[model samples]
Target: MGEIKYKRILLKLSGEALMGKQNFGIDGDVVKFIASEVKEAYEMGVQIGIVVGGGNIFRGVSESAKGMDRVSADYMGMLATVINSLALQNALENLGVPTRVQTAIEMRQVAEPFIRRRAIRHLEKGRVVIFGAGTGNPYFTTDTAATLRASEINADVVLKATKVDGVYDADPVKYKDAVKFDAITYLEVLNKGLKVMDSTAISMCMDNEIPIIVFDLFGKGNLKNILLGKKIGTLVEGKHD
Candidate 1:
């Protein structure tokens, strides 16, 4: 294997990536594809932790959730994340990768409650750890939860798996002349209001000194390529050249 740039990583997967072509909910094929990608990374001996969003299943702030009590809707959204986490777990295990699902909410029946020491132990033992249910708090985005968990685990970096290849000045899909950055600083991301991640998430990563890589999750081999230090995505860190 080539030199591994990062030994431990937190992978932030958006729920919508699991939707594939469906209107909502998990798509079996997409989950399998993602599992395959992650499996390849695990084979390279990279310790992995995942934080999955619930947008595909439900979103507390979306129009579909309008008129509902804010806290109630957010709790429902947290449940959605558990469902997604379980699905991804099943997929990874089916491919012969040892995996565990840890939830922020205490649902002992489905998965273990989030524990910092136990999670670190799992990674040391060569098992992949998946974090679900956000921060178990209302109004906190899953993005923030991912950063928080990364910080606790002392992750080397946060790999944000998105549909886009990297961070752009504008929506590349909507604007034809969007410019991409090879690397950017956290302060620039906040000062320019770039949407690589939510403000809270970005701030937490900055404070913790964890670099963030925004990359195209759908690109086959991209995950492994990143571990090999090929620079497949936009790097967001404390400083840039």
Candidate 2:
């Protein structure tokens, strides 16, 4: 393996990324592919912690939440994240990678409750830890959960896996001339109102001085490339580049 830039990383995957080409729900093939990518990373000796979203299965903030109690909808979304986390855990284990699924909510039968010390221990034991249930709080995005976890675990950086390759000034898909930033500051991202991550998530990372790499999860080898210190995505740090 190439020289790893980060000793530890928090990988944030959207629920939609697990969907593959499917309209909804998890796609088995995509999960397997992602698992293989993660396995490669685990082999590199870099500790990994993962936070996956539930938008594909159920979005807490979507229209479906309209008229329903906000807390209730968010709880439902948390459960959705648990489903994705379990699927990912199964995939990683199938590849012979030791993995643990920890949820913010107490799902004793399925996964262990989130415990910082236990999670770090898992990483030290060469096991990948997957965090699910979005912080066990309503109105908080999985992105926030990722930053929170990364901070608690002292991860070198948070790798946000998105469909887009990097952070662009505008929507690259809609505007042909949109420009992408090779790197940016957290304040710039917040001041410019860049949607790379939600405000809460970005602020938490900023306050903690943690770097974030937003990259395309759909691109083959992108995750490995980033882990190897290749400039495969936009790097957001405390200072601009």
Q: Please tell me which predicted candidate would have the highest TM-score against the true structure.
A: 1
Reference-based lDDT, each prediction = 0.96, 0.94
TM-score of each: 0.99, 0.98
Write one digit per residue (lDDT tens) for candidate 1, span 12-65.
Answer: 999999999899999999999999999999999999999999999999999999
lDDT of 2 by residue, 3-83 (tens): 889999999999999999898999999999889989988988889999999998889788878888989999999999999
Off by over 4 Å in 2: none
RMSD of 2: 0.9
Model 2's TM-score against the true structure = 0.98
Candidate 2: Cα lDDT at 59: 91
